[model samples]
Target: MLLAMALTLWSSIFLIIKVGYCYVNLSRKKGTVASQSSTHEGAFLASRSIDGNKGQTYRECSHTALGHSIAWFQVDLGGEYSLESVKIYYRNDANWCPYRFRQFYLDVSNGSAGSTTTLTSQRKRCYKDNTTALATPPSVIDISCKETARYVIVETTYNAQEAIYLNLSGPVLEICEIEVYGCSVGRYGESCSRCHGCSTCDIISGACQCGVSFFGPNCSNACSVYCKGNLCNNVTGSCTNGCEIGYYKDKCKWTCNPGCKNGCNRNSGSCDNGCIDGKYGIECYDVCSVGCISNCERMTGTCMCKKGWQGEKCRECSPTFYGPSCEEECSPHCYNGTCYVNNGSCIDGCTRDYTGDKCTQGLYETSPEDHGTAIGAAVGASIFVVIAVVVGVVTLRLRRKRDDSSKAQKDERKESRIKYEKETTYVNRQDHSLPGKDHSLPDSHVHLGKRPANLKTQEIGLYEIMDSGNGENKTYENDVIAKTVAPVTNTSNDASEENGNVYLVINESQLNSSHYDELHVQN
Candidate 1:
């Protein structure tokens, strides 16, 4: 019974300790509630009225309770304020709030209080934090107040809710202060607009700087201007110094002496004082006087000659004659013959009775001994005739024989004339009597007549007589036999008709018999 009473006493002590712990926790929560209630009084103002902890500030509000579990607070600053920036102190202690509030909304209005108008809105978030790091919240937020506005509202989009307490077992949210500043018109941060001829500066507010190769407030200078090494002047848009010799143009950058290794004038293309005579190429390096003949220029020797003159020096004929020495004359021979000055042969053959170089000479008499034996026999016959014949009888017989021979020769000549006429006349005679045959006679055969008595004696004798100038009379015996034949005449009318119809009629037997004795004598 005593041990049981001791145990009961211990249990009572433990129950008292538990009750004391609960009372302390309740007091702590009440204190926190009081602090929050007091801080909400001046939360409408931009600047904090109370500082609960480091970087912790309070903002005033017009209404204590704003409908629903979530609430919104708004403050109106009359007119369009050039908002330099905004600052926020976020409450982030796990022991005070459920979780850290991460996101917030900033809204702008037109008036100070009643009938406020909203101009714009923006959402923002706080940076993450560590346990030991100081809770210095972001101090600045930029806003373009292009439109006029009076009221600005800060609304909580996210809160430290129960989701963040699974591991850390408490809420984490805080705010120490909020600050706002008015910036210059049309200016924000370190950047500003150009004003009163002043150039627009950079974001850092340093002097308006230009590009590496340019200068001036607006960077209007060219790259070549103000350049030091082969540089251009800053004031002007040209090179600072002119180009050196053998160089020209802007900054002396281009080489004026191309293809000239020795060197060249930057302005002219002459060598030494002027180009040497006969040298006139790009660098005056070519020799042009060697092969020129006339009108050769001293600077650039080129030949000009008259028509039909050609050669390196115009010293030869213009292709009219072809020879190594150009001295051979053109050929001149009869009948289209071509005879070289060095050799004498006609292209075809020498002309008749012409001999010697180029066949220009006439015929000359040959000795009797030089004449053939046939010619000798002809001479011998004439001599023998003188011995055998008496003057009177021989003359009469010779005259008769001549008449017969002339008639025989006339008949032969007539036959030849008829043959020539048949060959020359180009008559297209149709032989209708003999069908399927046509005769074409030459034009020369159109006239049928006796041959001329001037028959060539050279052809008849087989040899030409050299000369016939002897005082002694020489003749050949009348070897041709003669017969006293009556002349033929057509007395009867029927006979005349028959004779007229015949084209030609000759007695061959009579002509042969009459010429037989002469043939034998000549043989």
Candidate 2:
């Protein structure tokens, strides 16, 4: 019986040991899983390349048939724990991949050495491009474990042959840091006291309190004075109805008296008693009336006129002067020692016998018309002399005409006798002349160039010429011939007629004859 009992006790103890071993192993596995899965609070985890190269070491997963470039990273939670989310900070090296880890697999396991089970799997492209550098971090992926996870593993889906030699060949992806978080267990009371009963709370303090200008556990109550009446000092508890005496609105700080027109004290709202000496009015701007004089002090007072003036305010002249003053005397040219006070002048041509100052002097009597008649007689005598001179000129002209006619007749008879004598002498001497003597004479003398006496060489009037041409002709008057023959023409032909128009002509013969006649008439 004892042996059996010992055996039973030993078996029971063995069963107990076996149970203890299993429990310990299970606890260890759970601890390992928790350590692997629990993310570090506020800590960054970096995924670096083994070769320590830059962008060439990491790459983002592709989407072609397979996926983008793949990258793997793991986190070990210290103990058995539950986590609601995980975050990875990563930067893409390629420009094509900019989204975070949108498509990824999160694997969780029990312990340090156990199979991994994917807690969550996603297929969306997380990054836009992959030009990110390795120094950059990874993005976060929240995986709900619901109080069950411990170890966590990340797997990126990549395109087939997207990476060459474990480096990104298509687009590179980089990871600079990582962060993980776990939900708090109720065993330690509320995880955050500040947000205990509030839907939102302060992230740093974690206290259950209101935000600015608010109160109450859930930030539901607002302070009263801040939103109501006139401004009230929260700290001093003071209320203001209006601004003080000299102060205006807008915090009751500005002063007012400086702009008051009637000498007001702005601060006290009181008026000063004194008015400006020369001014009076609401603002002391009106001036008092003083008359126009150097000594007048009041604006409305009358002015004192000088020695010889009289009128209202001394503005009128004296009676003697009739101007602005009464100091002037009447002029001296008035009639018979009297003076016209208004105009200061003498009366009507100063009277016949009066002259000198005020027309009081006697004058000498004389008739002015007698001198005018004497001047008229002298002018008449001058006119008679001018008429006599004109008559004398006419008589002399008539006498000259008669003398010229008689002298011309006498010269004509003498010229005719001399011409007959010269012709007979030339004819009588012709028989006694030598044969060569005829050729020896000058050309002019040979052409019957003998001088004649008794040539009638007078300028005759047209009447005389017509009377001689026609015995008793009266076609033209004597005055007409004198006027017409005043101008003479010298021409090549002594006399020519063309189309019944007579033209006086002159040649060498006419010129010589006319010249000789002019010389003889002068002698």
Candidate 3:
């Protein structure tokens, strides 16, 4: 079934193929033909080659001079065209010489037909015949040129050796007929349809190769105005790279919402980077409150309000206006009808019968007796507070005085102790001296021992002397042994008066009297 359908479809397409609609032969008596030099008294002029005749006789062929270094035959197609193919019918006569058209080449150019500079400098070689041998070659040859030009030329170089071998004067060109098939500029296809806004196109399909600012099969459609460079995909008409700022979508046809910051999404037209300040919503089209200090939440329209306003949209006045809507009146009893906007409180004192900061409390709410009692209570509380404060200050001063007095006593005792320590000079037996007396004792006699472990340095003196010791004075370094001395009286005599008594320095007040008699009796 599919094969039958395909055959029917192809039959319909062939039925529409118009007759006589092939690409035109641009060289068929339509262009002026010329050659390097004519021969046989103009019998074989170059015009005969393009006269739509393929006869091999001298009347129908084009012949050039025999003595030229190179021979060329050319035709001017009158206008430039995109050439598709070319055909050449060589002369085949009873006295045929294949060497006459040996090693020939065809060129196409936009230059003039026979100008030396145009032929040599501006021509592009499109076809060459190097494979034909000395035997009779094909009578007709077709070449696929596919070039764009206004002139077509066939050229061959003269070979001196081949010319001598063939018994010819020089190289010569003979062509019975030549045909060039192509479409006019800006047109293609067998029917020569126009390629709108295209400089080149496929000759068979009519598909155009469009330039900038154009697209589509025939390149007739223009790119969108919002496109970045007026450029787009040639087939789909979509801007492939990106759209201009504030534009979105494939063809950049949709305008972005004004609230979008930089641009929008190319596929969805949503603000990808969010909205500008004071705008919200998916496309950033919703406006935020005028009182908003900065941008709002893009999808929610929530914003931070400025001073004096509140609420999500910042449409309501703040609490400074007495209420959320800012419509509540101040207290009527306020002084001069004026009050603070924040709390609706009187700026000055309240009027006659009113009381309290806001002037809203009435004096009739309480009796005079009750008011007086309240005042008396307040005054009594004040007096009690003052008495308590005075008592606390006096107690603090008495404590400080007692502490100072105790400190003075301790300072005096410390000074006495330090003085005693300085007065009690230490001496060994070797340093001891006295006049007419042996003050030095044996090495063991001057022995010193550690003070009692229970004694505190600040509470007791290390060395002490007492009047209870013998009349000859003595010093003891240990506190316990010093208390063991017994009382003695000095005799009033001349020898005793001549000697001085050495006493050990002591702080008598630091000693415990209760333990003294026990120590004395024990010693």
Instruction: Select the stronger candidate by lDDT from 1 and 3.
Output: 3
**TM-score for each model:** 0.23, 0.20, 0.36
- lDDT (CA) per prediction: 0.37, 0.37, 0.67
Most accurate candidate by lDDT: 3
> Model 1 TM-score?
0.23
User: Global CA lDDT of candidate 3, please?
Assistant: 0.67
* lDDT for position 224 in model 3: 90
lDDT tens readout by residue for model 3, 200-283: 765656667566777788788888988887888766779866899999988999999988889999999999998888888988
Error of 3 at 87 (Å): 0.8
Off by over 4 Å in 1: 1-70, 92-94, 97-100, 109-149, 163-176, 183-494, 497-523
* Error of model 3, residue 372, in angstroms: 84
- lDDT per residue for candidate 2 within 66-127, as digits (tens), equals 12344445545554443434444444555533343444455554433234333322221112
Candidate 2 yields a Cα-based lDDT of: 0.37
Q: Is candidate 2 or candidate 3 better by lDDT?
A: 3
> Residue-wise lDDT of candidate 1 within 323-430, one digit each (tens)?
334344323433355544334445455566666555555467454455787688888998877765666577667768976887768757555544543465321123
